[model samples]
Target: MNSIIYGPVPSWRLGRSLGVDLLCAPGKTCSFDCVYCQLGRTTSATTERREFVSMARLTEELKEVRGINADYVTFSGTGEPTIASNLGQAIDLARSILHLPIAVLTNSSLISREDVRGDLAKADVVVAKLDAHSQELLRQVNRPMAGLMLSDIIAGIKLFKSKFTGKLCLQIMFIEANKNFAVEIAQVASCLLPDELQLNTPLRPCPVKPLPPPQMASIKGNFHNFRNVVTVYEAPRPEVKPLNLQETLRRRPKL
Candidate 1:
């Protein structure tokens, strides 16, 4: 059987990360079909939250990797993890079973929802995405589902930051489309007062090419006020051997 738990995969920010996919559905079931998504286009773009994977199944998978060597057990897979209605329970269960820090990667589309915010609050680290500074750019880059406004998303992040005591890292994926808006995005990141700020480009194989390191360096300059700013080009990735190479590549494929 295919397991919901995969990887001790190398991560530039989180090191050797173990993945927990609550929504392990076929194709990319994201809320945003990003122009630079490595997983390709979004197959399902709805904002409805439901249980895609059962607790028993996730529990069984977690038991198999109880003592697995990993830096963090991440909630990310086939889609926006926040869309999983049982995310809070899954995070708690993963922590209790694996005894590892829980991290969640989310496209901020659903962050504005109270229930989604509640679910994400259970994580030790929440890497929230902020790719665009305006609604127009948001449509061009993130291509978020309808009804998701940029203003509301920003407001939601600030609200979550106010209540969340954990590490709230704002991850900005810079593409040719949004590179010039770095300062505007940086201004919002500053207002949210995230624990860390990540400057990323599409380094993986995708439709768009990554911004050169020199350009990314100039973008980083806009975020000079941030205490913990990590650029994708500068970050070091820890070497890791996945217990299931096939499964790891299914989600995070080789470049």
Candidate 2:
């Protein structure tokens, strides 16, 4: 599937990102089947943690990286990067091999596990999802795997943020379903105290549409309590191209 290493794509958050896929199996594998997922539905949704890809192979492929063309080495392709049993080791390998800042984009479903948070702690920037505060709406929007609770996820995120020394950005995606709870989500954000609050809406191939500019703008206002905030509607995307068609389709689109 050419899933080992792909893209030096223009990312809304990380700039030119070279994606490293962890769950590069035959098809999509993840813990959440979010309605607005660009990579489509999860073919194998699970709560287990195991090495889905070889750590040695990732190290070898990273050694073969050709140029100093990427801004960040991102663990983002395929599925939730934290689910990889070798994530902590993978981050270590990538760091020793490539002289680039590491970024991990996680769905935060696995954050309840202390090990998962520890693995993610290696990254320079961790973009964690907080789509909904209420469990019912979380279930509807994210459609997390069985045993994943909204309360646990929030608690884990809070714990991680408290210990994490790197940049922590809480990504809050707005849609029709969760737009009404902007204030509630902001309250949760107040507790986490992330370095930045990324206000986002879908901008990829998905059934759910991005909320209108004004609607999303209205939602952004509620998050003024945060020190810094950015939104997808007005944030300028880099003119450079992103991932190729295949890699673009394999990972979650621009957040």
Candidate number of the best lDDT: 1
CA lDDT, candidate 2, residue 17: 81
Q: Quote the positional error of residue 37 for candidate 1 in Å.
A: 0.4
What digit string (tens of lDDT, one per residue) describes model 1 on residues 147-204?
8899999999999999998999999999999999998989888899999999999988
Question: TM-scores for all candidates?
Answer: 0.97, 0.94
Report the CA-based lDDT of candidate 2 relative to the real structure: 0.85
- State the C-alpha lDDT per candidate: 0.89, 0.85
TM-score of 2: 0.94
lDDT by residue (79-195, candidate 2, tens digit) is: 777878999899888988898899999999999899999999999999999999888988999999888999999999999998999999999889989999999989988998899
User: Against the true structure, whose TM-score is highest?
Assistant: 1
Q: What's the lDDT for residue 126 in model 1? A: 95
